[model samples]
Target: MLLQLDIFNILIQGGKGLKPLAYRMRPQKIEDIVGQQHLVGPGKIIDRMVKARLLSSMILYGPPGTGKTSIASAIAGSTKYAFRTLNAATDSKKDLEIVAEEAKMSGTVVLMLDEIHRLTKPKQDFLLPHLEKGSIILIGATTENPYISINPAIRSRTQIYEVKPLTEEDIKQAIDRALADTENGLGKMNIELSSEAMTHLTQATHGDLRSTLNALELAAKSTAPDTKDGKVHIDLAIVEECLQKKALVQDKDGDAHYDVISAFQKSIRGSDTDAALHYLARLLEAGDLISVNRRLLTIAYEDVGLANPAAAARTVSAVTAAEKIGLPEARIPLANAVIELSISPKSNSAISAIDAAIADVRQGNYGDVPDTLKDAHYKGAEKLGHGTDYKFPHDFPHDWVKQTYLPAKIKERQYYHAKENGRIEQAFKKQYDLLRQAQRK
Candidate 1:
């Protein structure tokens, strides 16, 4: 209990402006929120609730610096509700009682609970009655998925919303706002952020606005003032220093981006596990998740097809899991996918078969459908000779009755040539060879 109060008090330190620049710049209204337009955009859930005067408990889950706490703060400010901050991991039951007493006196209080995934049963028990009676609105913030990490009792009471990571543009807007806001920002310092520095600040942090803002502050404060212009200049070097990451030019539009992506896929195709992982790490460091996910999925069906069918299927599943969780933890599922794909026997036979079929079609080589294979359900179809001489294989032993099925012009056409590259595909080839022999009759 004593430990809990100590940890909680440490976070609740000092007057406004004394805290971090990120804390000072928290949105005071839904309009002031920098990102998370899905939640606070026009006609969105949080915006709609604010506009409609329908306040409810909600759990905001996402990667950090994506405006979970800012949303809670904005809701309180806009609704004119008394706001209090607590740590579910550190704050105790007594802390909940304090918020409840305040809520009772003030009609309603907005309790922004950080790390709500760590809420103890005692603290939850103390908060439940107030939450039920509408005296306290709980805005639980967590990086973990609420469904998996939070207790069901609390989970059942709150609307769970996933906060997406901010885009480069969104982070740029926030940095611009911080640069220009005279009251709560560094506007008075005459700090000039170079365009190169701005790009690094926005893109290199992987959309972490808190890290971007603080790093901007550090760069501005640490650099000596320019004597000629009387302005503090923050350049790319200083930003790289503060961020502790080299600004690798990994923009989606650049040639380097495509180069990295090509190397990543080719490495896996060549069955170089370590090399593939190295490229994956580079892409991840550049925060190129979309491309990583996209390329991996494409490789599954295109490169790793019949050789290891289950591995291909699992690549899709791994990518889905990675997207749901987001990064740096997203790396885990992505890594699993990368390792499996790199070492798995590789093949492009599926794509090869499709390409062959497509080429023939493009050349206008697809002949008319055989009469026996044509649609025969309509009343006049059989009279048109469409269903004539068709053999229903289901009635025969082994379901092996065979007949001429392909069109006359392309009766000998064979597009899918099964490979014997791995155990699975070898088994597939064995069945395929058997079917081919039977079809020749």
Candidate 2:
């Protein structure tokens, strides 16, 4: 096996670096890993295997940037094994033979086979004997569900474990590590990442650690140091530029930032087409396409709600279309949605009702689920009085039954107070009033 390249030192010594911050900052030991405590935490499955020196061929499947490759690296680091990587999808059978030959001679080489589900039959045949003999410890990494995507032949020989998406804290921890490690990170530089910038990084990528680190690195390099402080102050703008999404002219979470979004939503809720269009243009001009989609969707269900169900549905379609095509052209569908939502009948009945119910739940003004509404599938369910006297609504003439589904204490509590904003809502209110009267009686 070839020696692992030290791209970090190469860059410091005036060489063109090849490896990314994510690859360079990979955990050298299992303990150094940021997250996935269920597998890599102290005395966890992977940890136990590493500590006992009894590593087995295993499949790690999960979303990308969730540390599947990092797990393989950490295992190799912990075990002091010769680690070699090859893409099963692109690499040929000859590549597998080379790794196998090395494993035979080198003793227990860790072969991190990427896209393991894409391993062709010929390559699988070549690699199986080596895996069976315990010469090569196969660490198969893939994004697909192994049970469904992987061949049974490979599945039978490997223990499968999921690598879950990183939590916000996990991504933050990794970022801190990369920013602090002088040998492999940007520790030498005077860089200060702002709080809102950090939040943007953590939330915008949706639990992707790789994207966060890379974005951070990009911000650090691209942003110039402050003349007065001599610190590279990476704020939301620089971070957004690095992300290529989440654009903000005003500092994120600032008064002006909140004001713009607040006014945008309120204008739509107030049914002012001109004002809504103006705010929409401001947001679009600032290049915050994501924020536009989010607020519009919220307004669809929250503001335009049950008053015009079809209009709200159309708003969703508009948002989806805008997201696919993006801005300039996205402005068209977004404008159409704005106009329809502004001119259409509006209602806050659904949002108000749900919020009221949520408040009660939060206050602990509830009780245990009634036995009549409890599951009766199990053998002892009837003995426990579960499903006892439970009426099947479908068996009734109107497909309706006068039975409480809520917990005992909250049986009479109403959550959905329908409005008379539109014909549909009026009809719903009529049905709801009738149902409540019968049930209460």
Candidate 3:
């Protein structure tokens, strides 16, 4: 009868018995929350807002599991404001209006939008009027940069709070808390985590609290049941088995992406084919197709221009091919193009010369475009003698003419410095020298 009673209790409890502990263990109050002391710690912006009961619409920008949602929930729990949660991934503009209407009827409504960056421009525009009127206090959480992802109009209205990742120490403390809190944690299992295991788990988690807790739960459950040891021991080997695969690689979203691409560009510029290929592979593998293409196109113009003009042509062809073929197979043509570009002799000051000339114009360092070069197509343009003295280069020898092209303020400005290493550039150098000598005579 006693044995039957024991089996019945186990059946009744089941997985629900263990899951509640995990759910209930979530920090109920902001004070109990781990990490993010910068925002939630005493005297911080969020801390002051909660304490003063003066909440406003804001954006929470950070990586995953950084307590963005949790902080929003904590605010809802502690305040008199009505909290409405919606995911931007699937939530529609109609849904937002519904929430706005609710706020109109009720008191202050805190609308928490998760993955807010995913919201389309039209959908984002829906919230603008309500945000302007302060009808609903929006709390938007996203992993991407709010500046890049959020509409400028919407961004202008919201205060952006940046959240940092949890530290290794913070992760360790969270693990210990999970083990000690029996109600919603591993405390009931009497698990004893070795220093080696603890270090492994902490380092492996990469400052994500949710992942660390989940790993701990898995390790604890995998322990041998027959062991007479009063305390459940988790070792490094056990942790390795539990984790199995390596942790996902971290991506630095904005400037870091550009920085990596820049490195790859410079490698190709310096003719370091190995380094260029490595960076290309890294970006391709990481799903930076648009970025890779942008750099490749730039390389085509700025590094391979004229010297081996085919290099630029090949890059464009490769990009077109990749667009049509897409991944795996596309990688091959892209790789071949990159290799050809790295080996090609290079020259490219054309764009830079134009850029400098434009800068001079913007600074008012130059006058109008030479009257000779102004458009003669317009009716009045010809009357103004726009093309009066224009020398058509094609009508002259070598499709070149020795004439003043710069404006009066910067007539002597030297641009288009030719690189002499490539045959195309060497020809250009010889032509330019001859033109200058003729002009001098």
The candidate with the higher lDDT, 1 or 3, is 1
User: For each candidate, how many residue pairs have backbone atoms clashing (under 3 Å)?
Assistant: 0, 0, 1
lDDT of 1 by residue, 353-397 (tens): 999989998998878898998989999998999977788998888
What is the alpha-carbon RMSD of candidate 2 to the true structure?
6.9
| Residue-wise C-alpha lDDT for candidate 3, range 373-429, written one tens digit per residue | 888987888789898889889998778776767676676777677777688778988
Q: lDDT (CA) for every model shown?
A: 0.86, 0.85, 0.76
The numbered model that scores best in TM-score is 1
Model 1 regions more than 4 Å off: 1-17, 249-259, 269-278, 284-302, 310-340, 347-422, 426-441
After superposing candidate 2 on the true structure, give the runs of residues whose Cα lies further than 4 Å from its correct spot. 1-18, 34-68, 79-81, 100-179, 188-304, 308-348, 351-390, 401-410
**Residues forming the 10-long window of minimal summed lDDT in candidate 2:** 1-10
- Encode model 2's per-residue lDDT on 1-441: one tens digit a residue: 111334354334445655678888988789998889999998899999999999999999986798988999999999999999999989988888898888878888999999999998988888888888999999999988899899999998899999987876898888888888888898987889888887777766656788888878767766667889888898887787778766443554544555788889999889899999998887887666777888999998898899888988898999989976876899999999999888888899989998999999899998998889889999999899999889999999899988887888888788888878789889889988998898889
For candidate 1, give the lDDT of residue 213. Answer: 89
Native-to-model Cα distance after best TM-score fit, residue 360 in candidate 3, in Å: 37
- Winner by TM-score between candidate 2 and candidate 1: 1
Q: What's the CA error at residue 76 for candidate 2, in Å? A: 3.2
Error of 1 at 22 (Å): 0.7
Better of 1 and 3 by TM-score: 1
Give candidate 1's error at residue 92 in angstroms.
1.5
Among all windows of 10 consecutive residues in model 1, the one with the lowest summed lDDT is 1-10
